[model samples]
Target: MLNAVEFQAKIQNGLIQIPDEYKQEFGEGDDIKVIVLVQKKSFPKKDIIDELTENPVQVNSVLSREEIYSR
Candidate 1:
């Protein structure tokens, strides 16, 4: 198990989303992550640039995080 992680993203479908800033920073199929953690695990997530790529200049991205599961 791990703790909280912040990621830049935009809102869509009432769900947390990924940012499109990775296109230049990362690339196609890059294991891009904004935070560093000790415990790593697989996650079912939307592609970072899938939605924003259409119009990179239109959408505003924000940093989000994964709250630590302290149970």
Candidate 2:
């Protein structure tokens, strides 16, 4: 039977150290497959808004509440 484990870890000096919690699952000489996935950086809301809208819409000056509210 094959066992699988998943955990988040940071790489240092090009090495990924497995956590101590999973150490007992593997034997000293056992062969294992490894996969590395680099996490992407998240953008701040202000930065995203700036990127999305270089020229924002001018609404209040063009149309007042009276005009919009009239039915």
Candidate 3:
């Protein structure tokens, strides 16, 4: 049978240190699967809007007001 344990840890010197509470479940030669999940960083909405307004994207395709309304 296989068991699963979940915990959050910080990576230090390219090594992940497991919590002390879950340490007793394994031994020196135990084989375990490691899964790492990193949180996605979020940007401020106002900053993103400001950046887009400051440097807007340029498109070569031109659509007239009548063509747009026709759709």
Candidate 4:
């Protein structure tokens, strides 16, 4: 019988960092979904209202950055 692998999600700077342990569990092009609890921070009445009305930020599990060469 085949077994299913498990994975956990991590949030940093509004980015989702997928653990390397799941590399073998999922395929390179597979899609994954996870539920995250958004913390409601205490803010001033106006700030709180504005924040609540806006959409939350989400990032992919994997990401990268590049630097260009300068002459």
**Tens digit per residue, CA lDDT, model 2, 1-71:** 77889999988998888899999998999999887777878764577678559867666566678978995
A best-first ranking of the candidates according to their lDDT comes to 3, 2, 4, 1
Question: TM-score of the candidate numbered 3?
Answer: 0.58
> Which prediction has more favorable lDDT, 2 or 3?
3
Q: Pick the winner on lDDT between candidates 2 and 4.
A: 2
lDDT of 2: 0.83
* Model 4 per-residue lDDT tens digits across residues 1-71: 35455445557799876677766676788766656666666854667667766965575663444323331
The candidate with the higher TM-score, 3 or 4, is 3
**Residue-level lDDT for 45 in candidate 2:** 59
The lDDT for every candidate, in the order shown, is 0.51, 0.83, 0.89, 0.62
Residue 69 lDDT in model 3? Answer: 100
Question: What would the TM-score be for candidate 1 when compared with the true structure?
Answer: 0.22
Candidate 2, run of 10 with poorest lDDT: 43-52
lDDT of 3 at 70: 100
Model 4: CA > 4 A from native: 1-10, 39-71
Candidate 1, position 1, lDDT: 32
Candidate 2 Cα RMSD after full superposition onto the native fold (Å): 7.6
Off by over 4 Å in 2: 42-71
